[model samples]
Target: MLSSWLLVACGPSQEPPENSSLTLLHPNNPSSDTETYQTENDFDLLVSDYESTQRVIWQKPDLVIAQLGDLSGKTVADIGAGTGYFAFRLVPRAERVIAIDIDQRFINFMDSIKVRLPENVQDRFETRLGKPEDPLLKPSEADVVMLVNTYCFLENRIQYLKTLATGMKNEGELLIIDFKKNNLPVGPPTELKVSTAQVKAELEQAGFKVKKTDNQSLDYQYIIVATLQKPTNKIN
Candidate 1:
């Protein structure tokens, strides 16, 4: 159930003890302001059709890669990595590309795709089935974790991040790319769209230090790069 919680987000009243173990909380449903993820046909259309305005003008997948320079030997966790869109492109440069999605079908599809690739290329990629709150990442492992058009799908946003932080390296970067709230011709309904400022605040509240904000990179969406606050110090 999405209601299951493994950890809680940081706050003046919700601050977790330093020795606490990680937790992931999943709400019974998505937030009222947001729409749910696509099922059957919608999922097919979304992943197969990449020629939409979001891709051509925005050049989204490529644009994100270009901004994060020199991914060689780095580990990238592509959260909500549907159809292995960014995961396939990242494997060549990244030492390990972990493609995470809540959908088993997506993971199955990526697995089938990998079966046809050369042996060397197959070794660089992996697919993980992630839950709404828990991505099931190994603690202190990834170098970079990115979510493209995936942030808003989360129901318990802040608490989810707290658990996600456990899966990353101290200096790891967290990237988020999502639609702007300006009534774009396409994308999730305006009411479901989260503003960049709101996104930044949520991340900061969850202990991420916002490093860069680029609103011009995409015509419809903006990108924010924030590093997880090290435990004094601090995953998927």
Candidate 2:
């Protein structure tokens, strides 16, 4: 279970009008990319916020674990794992959990956490520095690759999905959990939000098929699980 998202600052400033348009500054912009947002370390701040929020909002992490099916011996990858939230949750269940993030600082933090990991999960967790367009994992290396509440920040959805498909095993599953545009006060605004329909369509375009869509969570978010399709042309 991820954070409740209630920690978002809600001051007297009225929620931006429903259709309010705010300019989205791309993270990869050559000129403005180096400009930092908040002074606090982004990854650490995000992790602290999420950990606190989840404690307040979510009742069970088991629900998400169960939805992931069997991970007892699977090689799982958590893409955009800010503070290893999902990665840490999965390490006990998976044979190995590859926690990937675009920030090297986050990876370093994850490495620090590795020392105090439970005996069973001691050597099962590894961190990888990834980019927005590429996950950097070898092809067919994972039984599952998950993007939990992090898909919206991806600069290229189609390329990212394609990279994910290539990184997964033939029967692997990809789980994407994100906030519902209409309900969540946290995360990007509605205009920048990626809808369930948009996610499904994008995955399908990347040659994956929707295996399931579940709204079981009581929060303002949803989950979509998609399976990679067997390639038709084997003889290239």
lDDT of each: 0.71, 0.71
Lowest lDDT block of 10, candidate 2 = 20-29
Alpha-carbon runs more than 4 Å astray in model 2 = 1-6, 9-36, 39-44, 53-56, 118-120, 232-236
Give the per-residue lDDT digits (tens) of candidate 1, residues 1-236.
11101111111123333432221111222432222221222444334333233344454577788777888888899998877777898988888999998878778989999999999889889999998888889988789998887787786888898889999989799989887888664455577678999999999989999999999977778999999867772242
In model 1, which regions exceed 4 Å deviation?
1-42, 50-54, 233-236
Clashes of each: 14, 0
Best by TM-score: 2
Estimate TM-scores for all models.
0.79, 0.81
Which candidate has the highest lDDT of all? 1
